[model samples]
Target: MENDKKVIALAVRATRRREQLGGLVLVAPAVVFLLLIFVAPIALFAWRSVDNAEAWSALPRTRAVLRAWDGTGGPPEPAAAALVADVNSLDRSVAATLARRLNYSESGMRSMVIALHGLSLSLQKPVLEQLIALNPRWGEHRIWQVIDNESGRLTPYYLLRALDLQLRDGGLTKASDQDGTFRVIFARTFWISGIVTLLCLIVGFPVAYVLATAKGWLGRLLFIAVLLPFWTSVLVRTMSWILLLQQNGILNRFLIDHHLISAPLTLIYNRTGVYIAMVHVLLPFFVLPLYGVMLKVDRAQIWAAASLGARPLAVFRHSYLPQVMPGIVAGLVLVFVTAIGFYITPVLVGGGGDQMVSYFVAFYTNSSVNWGMAAALGTLLLIATFVCLGAFRRVMGTAAVSGR
Candidate 1:
């Protein structure tokens, strides 16, 4: 017995060591791949969002002047000359943007005007003194704040721009109406995604219920039909909706021939088109999860309710719906999360006004060269997704406790 015990302990140690080795070997490749592809790029791009200090780094003259200056005092003669020289070297428009960023900290930065005048002036040091004296506002802490803030190479300007806010004259404020703000775009994205998610739940719930209730070969056949869309690419499916929903497309032609309406009606490239495409694409997400949970429900409770003086509708309301509530919550979470991140379907079917937050994020990445703003928007979407998911889970948890 003693010998057998020793052998068993040795075997157990050997097995544990082997398992640990295998686990490390399995995870090492994925860790390396993620570090290279996902982790590295996210860190790099996050750094890019703060890369606004280029102006100060590029202009040594400006740095030299502002180096010794205190934050409370106005710019001295040397600092003023350095700033003028720095402004002259850059393009007027670029200079103006930099000045605006700096102006958030600096109260009386009239040097921006000199910079805007094509860097033409060769002002003496005393000229700056006179300029500040003429505009006594320059001597305040605000002017020094601007210079100090702009001294850094990286700024949070682009991130703020993406949110449609700007730092100006020592404070953050809403962006001008002229340069498109994100307020409307963000609201529309949420509204459209919400509507699409609700439609998916409404349309999919009945289908899932029917599929769940079916038995034998008939149930299997119905399940296959729901799963059929999985064989096609999302882009292909979206394009098919576009073809069918267009004014001259098959759907319109059928409606027109059947005299459903006066004209073919505008369906494609509008809000309605967006909804149709999104619902069609996302229906699968809703049905599959609901079907999974519905399959596990004990049908005895439902039939027992019907047997005990309860009507069919009452049995469903009191017993069947409660059984399927978990599935409904799961399906809603899945469909809403997927819909919120939709870009291709909305872009293909939605008009300029219908474009969502995804559209803006893509635009920033591809056309605007503003990754900071893109990251900011992506972060916002991620936060929104987590919040919704958390709420769904909490509600479901409460429902489960109440049911118990």
Candidate 2:
């Protein structure tokens, strides 16, 4: 009998282990899929934010020599010789690449580097004197300082620039007015997103409440109407808004015909157009989550509050709103994050001044071919999104516990 009991216990343990392994196997594909498709790209982009290999790779020997020099004086003789050797060893195309890389750190360095390449053929001994003779700028310690500073394989230059700051004289400082646009752009991005989220909340809450409390076909129809936008492409929906809201478009013409206005309003190609399109697209995001939460709310509690001599407004404030706070927080975070990163609608409908950070990210990635700046901007935006999400969760968690 004892042997049989031990056999049964062993069988139960084996069965549990098999179940656990099966569960893990079922989830393995999803975990691997997220790692490859989502996590890996994000990691690569974050790395690109600080990856500064161009200057170092192009002037490896020069970088080694520069590391030993004191920044207070003129370039040392060995560093100058290393620069000459490095320039001579590079092909013409590679030399041009080095010039471009240096130019990013200091404007006009490209022209100087290219001129040095030409002077390399007729070079004399003591390359330092020849370089100074070839270009007066080479005599300045600041010029070499810029080169030495950028010779690292990794740098905070792009990330600092994204935050409207700079590394100067081995320290952080505020960027100049011209280079300070990034902070303003980031502010604008968040400001617009916040406004859009507010608009969606104002419009979505009542609609979701009606949908949740209504009965029969009316509720179903309204829910379907809210979701109908999802069936259409966002680009198509934005274009449809343009057709309706543009000057001399259907909306303006209708208002003019009805004597509501004497002239067409300037709507498209501005912040107004951006807001209209974004709110229209993101309203459903707000509505769906609110509707789901409202559905789970206890109707009996609300009615009980009303029955106990509470007015309609009081009942709603005390009994209904608390239950729906989580959904409101979730919706706000989703809509704000999505609106912050919007590119297509903003580009198509917004003026240059109204464009968001995502537009600049695309500009750097595509037009400027400045991957470091693009990645740094993207990382900053991601960090902001995560911060907002964390704040929302913390606030909601507190509200949930306190309300109970």
Candidate 3:
């Protein structure tokens, strides 16, 4: 009998080990997928922000002209010769295009273009004359200054601009010049996400509590309804909101018919629209976590508190609130992080003023062709999200430890 029991225990141990191995094998596919899609692209994009030098392609010209050239306008003759050869080789028309592209690499890049164009004219007048027609100012040293600055392999020009900083006179400084700076966009993004998180908590907490206390089949049905949003497309939901919130849409028509307001409310294509859509999309995230924690909560604890002469509100505030705080923190972190990266919902339902950081990220990547700025902005968002998640965990951990 003892031998049979030992054999049974060994079989169980082996089965557990096999299960662990199977789980590890299952995780491998996901790791590979992430490495190929998310990790590789992100790394490449981030690298572009700091990689400025065309060291291999234009090495001779770069070495010649830039050898004696400082950050100021006057580049050496050899550097000019190297640049002319490099530019002229890439395409006689490429000098101007390269100038524009490299300008993102360094400030005051116009001088480098001018310097290069002048050198091209001196070396090969026919090519320079044709190019010079496009921009007569190409003869000045300002263009060369731009070129010389950006000749390095790894550059911070795009990354710095993404953070509202610019390289001016060989140093990084804040860019207060334009209203559409990175700092402005970043701050607005943070504010919008924070507000959305607050809205979700304010609305979802009560709903979750009601769902948690519901009895029998009703509880299961209600919980399923709460989670139904997950099965639908976010874009579909966002578009639905746009249709419903428009001037002549169902919501406005109903309000107008009921004489709630004399005129059609400007609900769609505004910040309010953004808030409504975001809250709706994020509600499930808040509810699910709260409900999960609430399921594990002891109903008898509240009863015991009431029996100890605690009022209903006091029992709720002291016992119920603390018990569900972990869920609240988890839900808030998830929603806020997800909301910060929201693009399609905000774009479809929201106006220009309601664009989030993700919109700017897409703008820089697609429209502006500014990969550095895009990568830098994405990196900042990633860092912020991670920090928020970590803080949430810490807060929940401390609360749990103290609750004991």
C-alpha TM-score for every candidate: 0.77, 0.93, 0.82
How does each model score on lDDT? 0.75, 0.87, 0.76
Error of 3 at 158 (Å): 1.1
TM-score of 1: 0.77
Query: Where does the lowest 10-residue lDDT sum fall in candidate 1?
Result: 113-122
lDDT of 3 by residue, 234-353 (tens): 998998998899999999999989999899999988889999999999999888888888888988999999999999899999998888877888788778889899999889988887
Better of 1 and 2 by TM-score: 2
Q: Residue 369's C-alpha lDDT in candidate 2?
A: 90
Top-lDDT structure, candidate number: 2
Worst 10 residues of 3 by lDDT: 122-131
Error of 3 at 25 (Å): 5.1
The parts of candidate 2 lying over 4 Å away from their true place are 1-13, 121-125, 177-179, 398-404
